[model samples]
Target: MQAESVGIVAGMALVLKFGRGDAARCRFAISPLQETMSALLVLKDPGRHGWYLPWLRDVEPVVAGLDLGLLGLAVPSNGHGPDFLWPSPTSPLTRIEDDLAQVRATDPAVVAAELAEQARRLDRHTVPGDLYRALTGDPVAARETLVAQQRTAWRALVEPLWDRMRGLLDADITTRARQLADGGLEGLFADLHRRATWKNDELHLTGFRDGTVDLRGRGLILVPTAFGWPNLGIGPTDNTSATSPALVYPMLGTARLWEPATQSPAIVRLLGSGRASVLTETFIPSTTRSLAQRVDLAPATVSEHLAVLRAAGLVTAKRRGREVLYGQTPLSAALLNLDRF
Candidate 1:
């Protein structure tokens, strides 16, 4: 059955009802294409998404050369865009090529309908004349054009920085998995987003169009995205052909994702420059070797600082196989004014 908007509250909420086996079926995924589409919104209004300004500044040249007329029209500042652009990821490691292929393979009829829907949402009866004519005249070609543009966008914006982005995304998934294991679905949803809530087997997301989606045991896909800050996205809302429903939410550690770790003067005064720099970089988990490379310190020196910090209750170390990963403790986050979200 198709999910439909049920009722409207003062603050809109999209409610996804979980069935008997739905809880077990829910899983986390990382999508490069989803990040690409979200990045477009940031590009459209960089002021609104200040977290991405650092990235924007770096890609300004690429942004200036590209033709964003079509993509810009599709993804407005309000963040509602075509569903076909973001197909539900089948696995945790869904690739951009596979997602782009799914988009390219979209039915021409579906493309036409979605374009019309976008136009309607933008308060216009139809799209711009030339684009409308192109859609009505030959949707397959239009689809190809859109996909080609998307590929260009992926190469220019997301590809070069994917490793860093993926590291952040993977860390979030690891945290979510731990939440699921320790406290079950409740723990997972509790921290998913401030706008998301879990109650009575129903997952309600605020700031979304009111809807009731009965999963019917098909389950839900939880996607962690780097560029999906300050908003939650529900997919396959009404009339799209996706196997399962998905929720795209901003991941943790985004506020500092683009910023370089510098020694805070106050921190430095207290812990000395070397330890403070190591502490600053430990906000996100890293190994001693990686931390050394990042802070331009020797591995032994970083390890010594980590030992001191760990002994002082400022850092914690977890052993994963042969490598030991170090991360900040709650005390360290409070000291650094870092958001643990």
Candidate 2:
């Protein structure tokens, strides 16, 4: 659970908007875990066991910055589950302590060797180890090795690295980062320097591959959540080195777009309402209607509408139970009331 906070740090460091920490935080912050959270929310109802990881990613920052006494009301919550619920699993602080305890017991050198092996394993695209070793080897290698190394190296190396990297930012690195973060990340690429080429369904980033990444064909790439364009193009590394245990691959892509179909029109209308669209006809912060509720519209008809809306950036659907709910696109709120006109 705590290992997931690595994402919090990484998200805060890379994505610009998750900085001030709000809905924008979910947009830029919790995106990588979108599928994971959606799948869990689908497989079981929200607040179920399978959802621990994604929910933690979603709520941690808000909670960390929140005062415990007023946590309930401080959360600007609406809807059924996620926005209002906190899981009763171990507290994040407890999980952090447990993880640290296990880390303290292991030899740092051994963990480092294991991490190197894991990196090599990724390049080979296979876990090359005996069954016994595979079963018993470090599930914690990526966590204990790289993140720990980063923390250890931070005091001595962060300043030097920051100096080199910020030559492009034009001001002191930390100051610039805080400023850029607060400015909501729009200015991040204004005076950017580097060659990032778009090619063959992927982007190639150059000029910033310092020692932050090893020579294992692994570096970070940032892609847009709204532009269908690759932004910070960095590493998409598989952090684990064990047998393929249900792996998740996250794609950094664009916002759902709008099309000119029946489904598309309906979805665009709901999304124009400025709330989340759970299904084709549902409008959050106001109304939720099933396809059947929409007169002769068939269930499949509504599902079809949802698909179009999803493509057009008009709505978003996250899995829940046997049903899928749709919500409106926040981007096109102004046009919502015009549906009546």
Candidate 3:
């Protein structure tokens, strides 16, 4: 159905309303900063962020050993946090250090106010009495605490697996870019979420929240994330009031993120080692030469494997410039659970 007004029920959905002026402003991007926040969320409550439970368990030894002291403060157990921590998704992407620097530079007064808001949210819950005592009301101290915790969290969690996560995110962007090119906002939203829709120049997130954000020509940035699965988030991509809008959504192909490099027994039995490796790598696109280099197979051998996979309707190839990029077709994606990667 076409979207006019949507209900974004809490824990169910979030509807993002757009205006005529917002059409030109809609764009897709990848955000490392948002992923960091999501990883912290996973660490804080693996049950709520259950999609990553397996991932957390797989990395438990490392995560369990790390000091998570007071870091959970920045991520409210029940609500949102200060805007400075969620930086805007910039094209060409801003480095995490640069974004953290911005957080460190936050005005002390703003930090104090945000922490107070956070305290109120926590107080409403059945939290430990001593926990509230630990939260400092001093803005300077709170900000410093947050910065130290963030650095610790990144080193402990995100840095180790960032390359794989980034590869999946970049692949998602590539797929979405094709959608945007083929169908503009409509096609992009079609695959974005089961509830997200675009019609009459309005983007609707079909849930229960009753509100509207008029882009007013400010534009919107769509970011795909691996850790924020089963839920989507909408907000300003950065700390600046004037920063462009951004929407961060759960990405596909995350299930295999933590899977070991070894081939799945079932898949290997079905497709053999050479063909199975080719299939797994095709979850994201790669040219023959690139795939050969990555899989350490001869270019001709990789091409032959691609031909067989294409004939089996498990892969598709699209030409870009002088290269032909091969990626998994939907059928193959489902069979291999590539969507979960």
Candidate 4:
């Protein structure tokens, strides 16, 4: 799926008007496929997605030989790809396989129409002649080819790092859920994005195609994306469609997602280098084994350091099954000057 861009008008906003029952229906969702699709945008313009430079560098060799022509065409530079590639996820835990299946099952007619629309929207020079012909010649075959490419791309680019990415996305959902609990919709939308403002039971999203979407009680789905930083995306730009509208916004702390935790010199001086390294690795929750792998220490040694840190009130541990996950405490965050967002 390509990153779809709406026409931007200065000070213009897309207003989503909600009816009485919409608030009860609003919900949050996590889509692995959505992240995978958004990651493609990062690859296309690495300069704009500097937060993912580390990840892009790591995956460079893995994706070098992959046949990504169709994928590249799908995510044109203009950012108007077919919406069918991103079917509204049915649940919060929607899997990549499920999302791919939905894409495969898309009607060939819809596929053809969307592809034609995309070709019309994009520069003629950008769409290769042969590829466009093949896609237009047999829409069914084109869809299959696209699905196969998507699977290959997912395996090469996303599967290995999905665990860490999912953790960040899940953490964002937890934070958003708490905001909803503590301050209701107002507080939740208050800081969702600089351009998003909630007023009069309407969500005003600036810099998007000027339009008003009436949510006749169907509500909205808020999707938190790890790859979609510095921009907001709305789904089914056509307001007449029955599908529940969705807003894909960048999650907090994405800047730290691919960053290696650096041991603070002050903490190293205070707690010794080894213990300081262990504590820094807990900036994101990690098991002793993972922490050891990250810090290049033996698991037993990392476990010992974790024990000391826990005793010192600098780290906290929670058991998930047999493995205990260690995380930095607020005290440690203050000492390191790390923002928890």
Candidate 5:
């Protein structure tokens, strides 16, 4: 069946089945972030966001809101209603978490330290100038400062709550609902990818489509979403949800991503190496140093190459520890997979 049809049907089945209890349990487990994400999600993706939980499997792990694709907490989390769900009537110092009593449905204390720390760092208390100006209906005059502050508070909010085994949420009615709505996470992400920007780090997908899965691996790591499942798994050349372990953690850039991520800088370089100007239909990575290594190349040369690949929409890069790590643009990756199949 078409992914569209499959996703829709599966979603319907999920609501019919787990709509009440399990869904509530799942919501109860996390901080107000889930609610904020769900709210903001409604803005960008009404269908997937509107009381309808988006699902995914064999796909890019996406969190909610404008569907923020981890621009990096050098970059952070976003969404609407955070103030309401994880409300903070006071500023700079206030409890920004939701009532754990509700999510006691999950073992909150099990992940309490992490959760407490996260709550302590929320946007509500540490209102970034950008967030304050933006929320208080201030002018964009201090936009840059606002943006910086926003990033800080945002990262604080995003840095925790990846692990939550809300007892009632697992193997419950809600889980069944998601299952019915989605063959699994793979189906959900596929459908959402089609509806939102499904890029690597550039926000380029603009609601692109998917191809076949030609790879899978144990190196894979999945980040959990508000829905209580890993949003998507980053695996080696070959990885899939069915084979990988479900995961959660502090932040995307944590060393753990490297530990479990099957992401290959080598493959990215090999795939993107191309001097053929008229734009050879396909750029193949056939270089040493793996586009990620910036050892010998002059900083200018590296910049030029990155600019080119980024322009061609072949790869993605984010500055890390004074270095830029590049990877396949989600669209490009999907395209290559389509070719492979």
Candidate 6:
């Protein structure tokens, strides 16, 4: 029997839209578990996860030495495979040890069920039989393998960039929290994904499977990721069971993640080196002090450049409480895009 693809190559993509039942149950969270698992996905198929290709290339040498074991096998390189391996909605604050412990504690029944589901959704010979048995039979050992592999991935792939990644993820969460506070859940989902839409008590997502999820009070957990860009993932397939279904998608500020450490010559030519550096760093909203630290310029100097950029309409400023954050406008995006070509 052939298994269905998870949808990257398949004519159809995995769809995860929502309905009225999900409205009241929706909440936001950040999951270390999902981010770690996603890091593996980015590594496995750089093309599928190509949005992060530049970052992947930068860390390739670092991760080349780690033993990923069954991790890569679990999620096929083509981006289609089992869901049980990385079930969504663990916890906003789940630590590495805690997440690994949860994997170790999976009930045999759940494992069996998930295995059966995987068998139906994956190519028959894609996963080696021994690894499958290890995952489902001696599940305890499999959990240990999962934990060890994740730790290796963390040390190699995640730790080096944890500070920047954490900052981006936290900022996203804070922004979404503010959105929720201002306009409620509907407002929060407004800018979530271009493909995702909330309307008439239903959330519609395009470019993927057409299905409706009945929240039934379990609610939807919104998770933002630094690497889960260019695609949206909805999970815990059987939402009827325990563990809330979460829509894990890319955060808003990913374009800035790949910014070169040094200023771009093309941009430098246009704005001069100092203003160009400020322009590049401001792709993601940043406070004057943060931009100063990132570019190693004084706050006063960064503020002056920001004022000029804002005056020229290349950047815009918004007040978030006590501080004014500067971000790139369409003009800035155009400038960066031009540099890429």
Which candidate number would show the highest lDDT if scored against the true structure?
Answer: 4
TM-score of candidate 6 relative to the true fold: 0.67
Q: Which candidate wins on TM-score?
A: 4
Comparing candidate 4 with candidate 5, which one achieves the higher lDDT? Answer: 4
lDDT for each candidate structure: 0.78, 0.30, 0.69, 0.79, 0.29, 0.68
How high is each candidate's TM-score? Answer: 0.75, 0.23, 0.70, 0.83, 0.21, 0.67
The true-structure Cα RMSD of candidate 3 reads 6.9
State the local distance difference test value for candidate 4: 0.79
User: Tens-digit lDDT track for model 6 on 183-211?
Assistant: 87679779888767766655665555544
Cα lDDT of model 1 by residue, 1-341, tens digit: 11122232567777888889999999988788889888887786688666677898899978889875676666656645678877888776678988899899889898887877766666445457675555445668778878888888989999877755665786898889999999988999998888789999899877667668888878889898888786678888663334787788889888767988766677788899999999998877778877887788999999999999999999988775466778888999788763332
For candidate 2, lDDT tens digit of each residue in 266-293? 5345444222223333332111233334
**Between candidates 1 and 6, the lDDT winner:** 1
Clashes of each: 0, 28, 19, 0, 33, 2
What's model 1's overall lDDT? 0.78
Count: clashes, candidate 1: 0
Model 6 ranges off by over 4 Å: 1-24, 49-51, 78-81, 89-92, 119-133, 207-210, 261-341
CA shift at 99, candidate 1, in angstroms? 1.4
Worst 10 residues of 4 by lDDT: 1-10
lDDT of 5 by residue, 181-223 (tens): 6654333333332332222211111111233232222221223
The TM-score that candidate 2 achieves is: 0.23
Off by over 4 Å in 5: 1-32, 35-227, 230-303, 311-313, 316-341
